[model samples]
Structure formats: structure tokens, C-alpha cells
Target chain A: MSSLIRVRPTKIELIRLKRRRELARKVYRILRERLTILVNEFMTRIRRAYHIRKEINRDILDVYNEAAYLLGLYGGSIYEYYDSTAVENSKVVIGFENIMGVKSYTAMMKKGKFINTYPELNEFRERSIMLISRIIELGRIEQSIKTLGVEINKTKRRVNALEYIFIPRLTSTIKYLQMKFEEREREEKARLKRVKSMLEKHRG
Target chain B: MGVRDAYFEDLVTRVLTRELRIVNRHLPYKRVSLCDLEKMDIPYIVLRDGTAHLIDPRELEYLTNLLGKDKCKLLLPIIIEARQSLGEGTYIVRDRVAKRVIAEILGVEYEEEKPLIIYRPHLYKIREVLPTTTTIIFSPT
Candidate 1:
């Protein structure tokens, strides 16, 4: 059975390895910084989505309870209260103000056809549900976006680890081996030259 | 036919041919008995079915042209056809085509059943007697 012997590395190989390692470290540092920024932004968006969703849900419940109470008092649908000219004239100022606020908020959220989409609920009730649904949708979008962000961050970390640790370590080991091999070759060449001169002198 | 009419007819023909290709390519995979599908990888399924099996959200126009104006009606049959081809095994599909196919296989009644936004990482636990009622359970493990 033959034994396996290790060869030493050459200087040229060591230089090449060191250059590669330095480049890899620089790339790793840049990617890590980018990943940190992306993760931070993603977390902020997730928090905003959560807060907005909670606010929308609370507002929906409030609107539903209030509408139910008003319906009970009026003895009919809320539309009847709004449609009657006399009632509308009496509460026009305050009622218009409330309606205007709802309309603007819904519009700001880009929700249209609030009443028709949810005809089962009264106008105010429908508006509240629509707003809540929009908020929920926004939350869902944020969650998906956050997940992608997380995946990107993980990938970046993996790349950085490979660049900084695995590649550099492997390169250094290769360089050391090459230098040892080259030194052995040079020494052997010098020994062969010396032996040739000694044999020439002996002949002389 | 006038030039415009001929152009329209050609367009229709090309679309019909593409749709036929999509259906035909998927046919072999669909025709595979449900019992034989669990052994193959996802890329194999895609290759066997054809590239059309992957639906990009951006490529809605192509899908629309292939399916026709009555998208709501045609959506289910196309999905069922594709799923039937994929055979009987669990699959993780994030693409729109896969979502549509799953919805059809399960017989989800709603036309606007949204694409699954979240999936349980462990898909093997899903069991359903009816194809349409399967609930994907997500286990972190």
C-alpha cells in the first residue's frame, strides 16, 4: 500500500489566493449591509400594515354597533332615515359632515362602490366593512412582501458566508499547499545543479 | 375576407392552435394514473406537461386569448384538465396556473376564490375524500 504525502504550496499560488480572498471579503461586506437595510424596511412595512389593520377592524365594529343602535331607534332600515327629506333636512349639517368624512377616507383608501358591493349592510355599515376589507388586503400584501424580503435576506447571508468564510479558507489552504510544492521543486533543482558541478570537478 | 378580417381570423387561428398545444401537452401528464405521480419531481411534471403549464401573472393576455372572453366559466375546466394530468400526488405550486388548477380540482364554488396566499410547509398531511375540500395544513416542522 502506498502512503499519500502532502505537497507544500508555491508563492505565486499564495498571492493569487490572497487576492481572491480580499475580493470575496469586500463583496460579503457590501451584501451584508444591503441585507440589513432591506430587512429594516420590510419590518417597518409589516408594522404599519398591522397597525392599519387593527384600526380598520376597530372602526368597523364601532360603525356596525352604532348603525344597529340607530336602526333600532328609527324602526326601519337606515336608508329610510337618510332618504326622508324631512329627516335629511333636520340632520343635514351633522349627517353630511359624517358622510363626508367616511367618503374621503374610503376614497383615500381607493375603495369605490362601498354601498353597492355590500348591499346586505346599511350604507354606513357597508362603508365600514369595505374600509376594513381594504385594510385586511393591505395587510395581506404587506405579509407577502415581508416574506419575500426575509427570503432575500437569508439568501444574502448565505452568499456572504460563502464569500467571506468558505471561499477564503479554501483559497488559503490551496495557496499554502502550492507554496510548499514550489519550494520543494526549487530546492531539488538547486541540488541537481550542485551535483552536476561536483561531477564535473571530479572528472577534471 | 378584407385585410383586417383576414388578420383577425389568422389571430384567432394562432390562438386556437396555442390553446390546443397547451391542452395536448398537459394531456399525457393528466392521463397518468393518479397513483403514479408521487415519484416524479416538479420539473419533470412541467416538462411533461409543457411550458404552458406555468402561468405568469404578467401573461394574462395570452391566457385570456387561449381561454376566451368567458374566463369565469372556462377557468375551472382548464384547471381540472391540468390537475388530472399531474396525477395523484402532492405538489407545491406558487404560479397562477397551479392555483387555478387546484381550485378546480377541489371544486371550490366561488369564481373569485383568490390564489392561496399562504401554504402550510408540510403539504403531505393534506387528505380529502372530495378533491375540492382539501385544506392544506402548515406545520413548521
Candidate 2:
């Protein structure tokens, strides 16, 4: 365990400790502000992510049903020799930006490699591509939310430590040091007065 | 104080300073008046949240005209809000001061006492309008 700061009965140490306490309070305020912003960002992202899932859900069933319909009409053999009408590939660019001082992913997508194929095959492939993009977007949301959550927690913990523990302890320590210094000064003044009286008595 | 306490206090101060620097490092390049956004060379601000939002001078002029310039003490920005009470994909504008400007943009009714709840597409619209000033923030529900 880390030991407590030792008591120093000096005016200088008291001033220094007071300065430290002021810094701690300021840090606490900044951290608390950051925490509020981080949480808001996290919540916003989380909500957006949830809605993305809903969007996917709404689009997916139709696409899947269309796919099944196309397969039934075109026959399973159609799958054997069909041109690629769907998106051949999708390139997802994941960007890292500092949000609330936490580096997290921001997604940008480039549509890639589409070809013309049979009508049914085209429909099926398109649905697949759409689903894939939505899925990728969903993945991006989740990753960002995760990073943000970690950041929010860290900020909160630091705010709590400074506000509840560090500031209070520093305040008390500074107070104690000031009190001790005052007491020592009073004692010295009293001793000096007594010595002066004794010297005067001796001279008389 | 003793050597250990000095060291400990120094450590705390150092850590706090580091955090402060990290947070401040990403602050907007500089806050500019809505009027000057377009005439200025760099018509953009990097939000503290780290989004590079571009401001359009035309829209700023349009808004200033709509809000009657003088009443908009602090120009206007679409503040997208995310609160626990709000549903997913929902953004709200609770600042009544900006509601008039947003109402002009969206053609929605503005209520002095109420907030304007908006959806994703509307969020896009606001972003389109005031990219730099409009920011998303989570509020306590």
C-alpha cells in the first residue's frame, strides 16, 4: 500500500500543499466535464448503432425473401453458372479520430467491383451486398462504442478520485501544516517574551 | 513535506496536467463569428469531439437572415442531443434559442418551452446546414 503523505510543520509546505489542492480541484473539474461529454458521445453512438440494427432488420428480411424467391424461380442450377452482378468487393475505411480525447473508429465506405449479371442473380447479389454493407456499418458502430465506453469509465474514475479522495486529503494536510506552524510561532514568541523579562530583571 | 509526499504531490500534479493537455489539444482551431466563417481562409473547426465539420457561408447568411441577425446572440448551430430518454437514432435540439433558426431550416414549428426531437435524416439536414456549429452531445436524461 502507498503510504500517506507525512506531516510537515512548515508554512512553506502548507502553501505548496494548498497549491496542489487547487490543481487537484481544477483537474477534477476538467475531468468531470470530459466525462459528461464522453458519456454523451457514447450514448449518441450507441443509439445510432441500435437504429442501424433496426434499419438492417427492416431491409434484411425483404432482401432474404427476395433471394429465396429468385432462387425458387431461377432454380438452384442458376447459382452454378451466373455472372457476378452483385458488388464484387466493398472497401471499408476505418478512421481513428479523437472523440472526447479517445481515439475511436469512424467508417467510410467505397463501393467496389460491381458487374452485370442475370436479372434474378443481380437482385440476389445486390441484396447480399446491401446486407454486407449494413453489417459492416454495424461493426463500425460497435467498435466505436466499445472504445468510447472504456474512455468514459476512465474519465469517471479519475474524476471521482480527485474529487472525493485527493482533494479532501490535501485540504486536511494543508490545514494541519498551517496549524502546526502557527502553534510553533506562538510558542517561540512566548519564550522570547519570557527571556526578555528575565534579562531586564537581571539588569535591575 | 517529506520527500515521499513531495514526490506524491508532484506525481498527482503531473498526471492532472497531462489529462488537461490531452483534452485541450483537440479544441476547435478557433471559434469564429458565423459571419466571418466563409470570408475566412479556413472555413472549418475541429470539434472537441474530433469531427472536422465544415461550415458553409451561404447557409450562415441564410440563417442570419432568418433569425434576424441581432436576436441570435450566439449565431446558430444544430446541437444534436443524445439522452437516455431519447430513442435510438434520435437527435434532439433542446436549446430554445436555436429553435427559431432550425425551424426555418426544417419548416417545423418552434415552441419556446419545448425541444425539437429529430431523426437521422433531419440530423443530416442540420449537419448540412451548420456543419461546424452543430454538434452531437449526450445529455443527462
Best by lDDT: 2
Which 10-residue window in model 1 chain A sums to the lowest lDDT? A92-101
- Compute the DockQ of candidate 2: 0.16
Q: Which residues of candidate 1, in runs, are more than 4 Å off?
A: A1-34, A74-76, A79-110, A113-130, A149-153, A160-165, A196-200, B1-141
Point out where model 2 deviates above 4 Å: A1-4, A75-89, A112-130, A196-204, B27-141
Chain A TM-scores in order: 0.53, 0.80
Tens digits of lDDT, candidate 1, A71-190: 776667655634442211211010000110011011112233322323434456455646656564464445445554655656576565556654656465665667667888999999
| TM-score for candidate 1, residues paired by index | 0.37
Each model's C-alpha lDDT? 0.39, 0.66
For candidate 2, lDDT tens digit of each residue in B1-141? Answer: 568867876887889777656655544554555655645543455666556544444556666677664443544344556554564556677766576667778888867788887776666666545543565554334
Candidate 2's TM-score: 0.62
Model 1 / residue A101 / CA error / Å: 38
TM-score of chain A of 2: 0.80
Residue by residue across B80-105, what tens digits does model 1's lDDT show?
A: 11121232222333435445544444
